[model samples]
Target: MATPTPTTDAPFGLDPSGRPLSDKSKVAAGLLGIFLGGLGIGRFYTGHTKIGVLQLVVSVVTLGLGGLWGFIDGIVRLAGSAPTDAQGRVLR
Candidate 1:
């Protein structure tokens, strides 16, 4: 039987920080973005407080039009092309 390679030994992969993978779930974040994007809840879930606040502010300032931005972001995340977590690690 072949032995499985260790995470450190995995080829062609690594977080930008050269650290272990994040435990965050893109699905969860995506859902939040889709349902509560105007509130920036998804960004907060991913540890991006600043972005979250910005989203919230935009949502308010634009009278909810900015919510489209968050909605799009949520779709992208669900598509598996999401950005890294605050720790610079890809979501699981």
Candidate 2:
């Protein structure tokens, strides 16, 4: 039996369609999360509309308690987690 080898045809992080995935900005996202997390701005910027909406609702319902969640996420982003967008593109 022979083992399959990894193909190097396309660049890393590209889809089979040979198209480059959209990238997000980690710094910008972090800043948004830190400053406007209560409104889910970071999540929206990251293409996480659903999560963003949820965060907004949570913030509104909990009287900005959700901002803490955003703040923590910002810290994570700033720490070089390099989160991906909804399309699975890594944040630059």
Candidate 3:
């Protein structure tokens, strides 16, 4: 089997600074979710491949309605109400 490549962003369990995450990254992620949500960029950045793929496929199939949901999720994320990632760490 092929090994998975490391992502450009931080690893699944840590941030660039080796800390869990600060509120800053979470907020930034949320903004990305709002702006580039159609591409699932934020989901990928935040290490949510499943959700990201779903968003990408659904967006493609539904003509960007997935983007609308992602946009709303962005607002929820910015409000510090969205669920944390697999690592159980809140964004930034």
Candidate 4:
């Protein structure tokens, strides 16, 4: 018997770079950005403390306009224009 070697052409279900995003923070961030993005809760959940804090401040300062910003940011992230997670890991 021989051990099966992993191949690069597995499928889209995994990351080609082999650094697949298994981090709960990233998933949570993505979800939050998608749903609660208006409040920047996603940013905070993903470890982007600076951005999260800024979002909170902006949302408060702008009387919830920051939520729009957060929503846009979430779109960009989900679209792959911005791939860094809260820990800055490029999602695959």
TM, every model: 0.76, 0.74, 0.68, 0.65
True lDDT of residue 68, candidate 3: 91
Give the per-residue lDDT digits (tens) of candidate 3, residues 56-76. Answer: 898999987878977876777
Model 4: number of backbone collisions: 0
| Per-residue accuracy of model 4 over 36-88 as CA lDDT, tens digit each | 87677877766677888888888899888778888877777776643665644
Span of 10 residues, lowest total lDDT, candidate 2: 3-12
RMSD of 3: 9.5
lDDT of 1 at 58: 99
Worst 10 residues of 4 by lDDT: 4-13
TM-score winner: 1
Q: Better model by lDDT, 2 or 3?
A: 2
If both were scored by TM-score, which would come out higher, candidate 2 or candidate 3?
2
Backbone clash total for model 1 is 0
Residue-by-residue lDDT tens digits, candidate 2, 1-92: 35333345323345444343345778899999999988999999999999999889999999989789888888788886446778776676
The residue-by-residue lDDT of candidate 1 on 1-92, one tens digit each, is 44433375433345544544556888999999999999999999999999999999999999999998789889888997546789777786
Q: lDDT for model 3, on a 0 to 1 scale?
A: 0.70
Q: Each candidate: what lDDT?
A: 0.81, 0.77, 0.70, 0.64
